[model samples]
Target chain A: MKAVLGNMRAELVGAGGVVERNAYLTKRYIWWDVAWFVWTVANTLTIVFIAKGIEATGGSLDVNETMTTLLIGAVVWAYLGILFEFLMETVAWERWEGTIEYTFMAPLSRAMHLAGQGVFAIAYGLVRAIFLFCVCAFVFFSLSIPDAKYFPAFVVLVVASISFIGIGMMMSVLPLISPEKGTQLGFVAQGTLLVVSGVYYPVSVLPEWMQWIAKVSPATYALDGIRKAILEGQGLSALWSDLWPLLLIGFVSIPLGLWVFQRGEQYAKRHGKLKRSG
Target chain B: MTNIQQAAIEALPRRTAPAVDVRDLSKEFRRRDRKLGRFAHRKRVALDGVSFTMQRGETVAILGQNGSGKSTLVRLLSTLLLPDGGSAEIFGHDVVRDARAVRRLVNRVSVEASFFKKMSSSENLGYASRYYGMTSRQTRDLIPQILGRVGFPPDRRDEPMESLSRGMQQKVALARALLTSPVVLLLDEPTTGLDPRSKLEVQEFIREIRSSHDSTILLCTHDLAEAETLAERVGILDRGQLLAVEPADALRRRFGATTLEEAFFAATGRAFEADDEEDDEDREVFA
Candidate 1:
């Protein structure tokens, strides 16, 4: 028991140290920051202009309503962007940079190393999410107070993002296994999630079976939960229905993601893919 | 903390074990052809009946061109990939059975190192150091010193990794591998694509580490000169076969050739520069 505790302590210490280092490294790359800046400016300007036109010419629409709707749309879009970024920008980027082999060679488990990489991506997500939220609130919602339900909404958003990121990481590992075939599967998965998540519209509009699919979709949990809290002024009690599902999705996806990633790594090694690439 | 004190501590006898061992180890991969249907796929032999052993502190160079299973051998021994046919042991610990133990003893550095492209060299190295269990202060102080020894430009330490030249990036990789200084060092074409000066600097660092520290080095490379300089014994690997292992001079004399290049041709019936056609779709195994 003592040995186990010592080892765990060592691992935790190692993980903490690594996080600091990665955070420092993340600051050097303007890539994520620049990407967020461009996305925010583009979305902000478009939403403001569109809302302006909607408010013009004696439409009965409240200025607050138009602005809030635009804000909700922007936030949802940014959240979706975060999901795909995990796949293309973080996991896939590892392969393109030829660091996959290096990670395989490191002292820590591949899972932990990937976790470290995943943290950097979460940083990117947080930056974009907060920026969008702030801009929308200040310009459109009069810096409106968050509903009591916002805490639950934020929790659901985090849970959904965590689950989706795992899925994205799993898909990223596929390209390493079979470049051509794995990539095709990745595209299909990405497109399917996008269509099913109800990012741009409400899932209630979908057909019955499709609505079920959206209910279980990670994006659906995040988008719907946030839209309810921020736009509809829903409270925490209102989101209780979606809470357990988000937790279940997160619990199941994390393990599955690790298992699939490890399996893919073993397959590549057994087959001598490294040598072929060399 | 001091050099002499550390050496004395390192010298205290504890255990004697072969740093690495392998028996009948083989790995095969399946590759599908998209031009054809799903069933129109095939299996390729990556490491076929590969077997070898390395004693502590001995440096061995496996010289092979692309697709000769050099990196595959390194990966299996390091526990990055499991063998399909046989077993491998590191320090008497099975790579598969005692993988966690094996992982603690080995560190691998490859030519194509991946870094957060937006991060600077120091930041990347610090991250690797932290992952290996270094504290913040140690990483902060140690990374710059190590990078300096490897000839990394001070000014470029804070620039994004993508902005650096390949040669400079390769130097940073060598620095990262040395950060933890594991018991076994596996370098997969470590100097490939490096500029002449950077290559020499890295080679010198490897030599320094081997002599100053108790490390068993396994280097896979296509550079004959590197094989001669860094390894005490060189193994010629061709078509997943280890044709011979001996000192460079011995290998030349055995083949009745005066140079490593000539001996390679005599042994493999081809030039060192010959292009290989074999491709394995087994990368998913590593994913």
Candidate 2:
């Protein structure tokens, strides 16, 4: 038991090291992130204005309600976008810089290095998402506060985020194995998810088949849980359905994602890919 | 016994248990591609029936061109990749059976060292120190000293890695490897692209680490002078075969050549410059 704890402590220290390293990388890329945020925010405003205009023209849209929902949804979507952008850039950038091979030679497990990339994404996502959300809400809804249900919603959100990022980690490993195909597929998948995950509107309105697809999407649970909590005053028990699917997704995806990453690493090593980044 | 058997028995290097032990180690990679209307792929033998062993604390420099299986051998011994047709052990621990133990003992320094580009060299080193189980205080004290020894200027320590030169970054990379003082140090082309001065600085640092620490070094390089200077025994790896492993003088004597380059040409039956052209082709895919 003591040994296990000691190992855990060592791992934590490694994690801390990665965090420190990534913070610097994040700082270096701050300007690019700011530019991306500007573009994404502009697109969000255009979306909100269109939604409001449609409601005014006998669209049965509650102006305030629709604005609130769209505002939060857009903010949440920003997180997804940031996550995808950073995830793709992580492997591709490392490979291009010829640093990925150096990373492979480190005494630490490859997964741990990968975990640092994921951590950077999560931290970047939180900052961008919160900033975008505040800007949208202030401009559109006069800073109308979310209700008390945010507590349980936050828990469900955390679970859903893990599963989503787990899937992203799997995608991230592609560039390491086959840079050409990996990058091509990474963009396609992220684009498809953005369109189908109901980032812009409710998943319920989609056709039955589409709804099934949405249910399987990690974003569905996250959005649904958040909407129920903050918008409808739902309690923690009300989030059981959302929570369970995410738990199941996380349970299955984390191990599978990690295994795929390890396999990619091994493939790189056996095929002499380890030298390319060096 | 005849002269051949007697010579083989007499010439075998003395080793209680080899620091690196391998037998019939072969690694085959399956290459997948899409045809006009079908998928076609084939297995390529990267390392075929390779066998060799090194004694404890020996510094072995492997000289091979691109696709000569030098990096593959390093990766296998480091337990990063599995062997398809043979077995390997590091200090008697099976690379496959005791991978965790191997990982703890081994440290690798490659020419293209990875760092958080935005972070300062100090920050990167601090992180590495923590990962290797060093306390923060130890990191604070040792990093600057190590970096200075490797020729990384103190003024540049706080700047982001992206701001540093390639040679400076390589210095920091070498410093990180020494920070742990690992028992097995695998260096894959530790000074490939550096200026001559930086190259010498790195070679000196490697020498310092070997003498100060009880680390067995496996240095893979294309530089012949580097091989002669940094390693006690130089191994010639050609087309996935270890053709010879001997001291520079012994290798030259065996091949009846004046220079290490001439020795390499005589052993591999191809000109050294020809391999440079071949490397140009190998480099195209990555670029």
Candidate 3:
């Protein structure tokens, strides 16, 4: 029992260290982050403005309601994007910093290292997502949806992050096996998720085959649940159908992602590919 | 600590076996020849049939020119690279089978002092120490202490690593490795790019580490003087093979030469200055 506790303690400390290093990296590159955040805000605004665009042109859609839906979609998309970017670029970050060898050879397990990175990404992504959502809804769009239940919407966002992180973790393995093109390949997963996950639109709009693919993406459930909660003022009890799938994906994908990453790491070590950009 | 933890700690000193036991260790790289054929590939044997052992607290230097498998050997021992053949055991823990244990026992300082350049020196050290299981309280004291011992400027601890000189960066790297007092400290050309004064300070710091810590040092370098002065035994690695590993004086005597440089020439059958594939195409297959 004592040994188990000690091991847990070590893992926690090691994971915390990974998060702390990233925080330091973030702090050091604060200006760059700010620039990216501004870009993200603008992107969010452009998507949410589509609702206003339709209303301005005399479309029959309810302007405020359409704007809120778009706003929620854009916010979730931004959150998921940040989460995936942080996790997927983990290897790129280590290599760019020329610390891949040191990190790979550390006593800490790969799982713990990734968990620390996950913690940082979730927290950072959530903060950005909240601010983005606020800017798009209240400041820029002046969206006021009566009877909207925000608490349940937040719960959906929090739960959905688990599955997104799992998928992100799986994508992070690409750079380990193929450093030359692996980082670019990570975006393929993101792009696929974006296409099939119904980020800015409803699932009913996608074709039959694409809708089948959308069913597998946790973001599909996430968008569904958040819309129900925020637009229709649904509670968690009514959102159980969406919540369980996210939980299941989180359960299976995290372990599967860890397994895939370890295999990729072994392949890298055998091929002598862990060195920085070589 | 539990009984298991206590037992593991107590069993750390396997005096019966060498601190590092590498047997017939080999590693090869598969490189493609785009100029030759579309699918043509050849193997470069970076380390071929190399075997050595280090006793507890021993400092052995492997002197080699560029691409002579010095870094490959260090990387293999540190669990950063997998060996193609043979086996290496660190204090009874196999590098492959018991990599986690070996990782705890070993730390390496490579030729390039890699760090998060945006972070401060203290911040980098703090990250390293924490990953090795040291708490914040411990690193708070140990980071500055280790930096001081390695001659890092106390005033510059908070400055970004990129702003620091290469010599200073190298100091931080060494400090990170020694933060946990690893049993086997692998220094792969730690002073390779330092200026003369900085080189001397690094060498001095290494000697201090040798005397102060119980760490067994495996110093791989191209510097002949560094091999002679810092290590009790010197090894000459040419191409992919180890020609000799012995005391500096003994090597010179065996080669019937008055100087260590002459001994290197005698063993490798080439002038010290002229030995290498630096300018050549290096397309030769190892076999």
Chain A TM-score for model 3, please? 0.96
In candidate 2, stretches whose alpha carbon ends up further than 4 angstroms from where it belongs are A56-58, A88-90, A109-120, A140-149, A190-197, A274-278, B1-17, B28-45, B276-287
Candidate 2 lands at a TM-score of: 0.86
Model 1: which docking level applies?
acceptable
Clashes found in each candidate (C-alpha, N, C closer than 3 A): 15, 1, 0
lDDT string, candidate 2, A27-71, tens digits:
777798689878988988877776679877878867766776776
* Lowest lDDT 10-residue stretch of candidate 3 chain B: B278-287
Judging by lDDT against the true structure, name the best candidate.
3
| B1-287 per-residue lDDT for model 3 (tens digits) | 22322344465856577888998999988878888799998677888888989998899999877777888889899998899999999998899999988888889998899998889999998887777777898678778888998888799999999999999999999998888778889999999989999899999999998997777899999899999999999999877788999999999999999998999999988776563564213522221
RMSD of each: 4.7, 6.6, 2.6
Off by more than 4 A, model 1: A13-26, A40-70, A140-152, A178-191, A194-200, A231-234, A271-278, B1-16, B29-39, B42-44, B113-118, B151-156, B159-168, B193-196, B249-263, B271-287
**Global local distance difference test of model 1:** 0.71
lDDT of 1 by residue, A1-278 (tens): 98577556556655665466546645655586688667776776676556567668656665665566556656656665555555543335555656655555555665666565566566667667777777667754464554434666577677676777678678767766765466567667766775677655567777888888877677677777777777677876787666667778878887888788878766666655433342
TM-score of chain B of each: 0.88, 0.87, 0.93
DockQ score for model 1: 0.40
Query: What is the per-residue lDDT of model 3 for residues A5-53, given as tens digits with 9 covering 90 to 100?
Result: 9878988999999889988988988999999989988988888788888
- The model with the greater DockQ, 1 or 3, is 3
The residue pairs that clash in candidate 3, if any, are: none
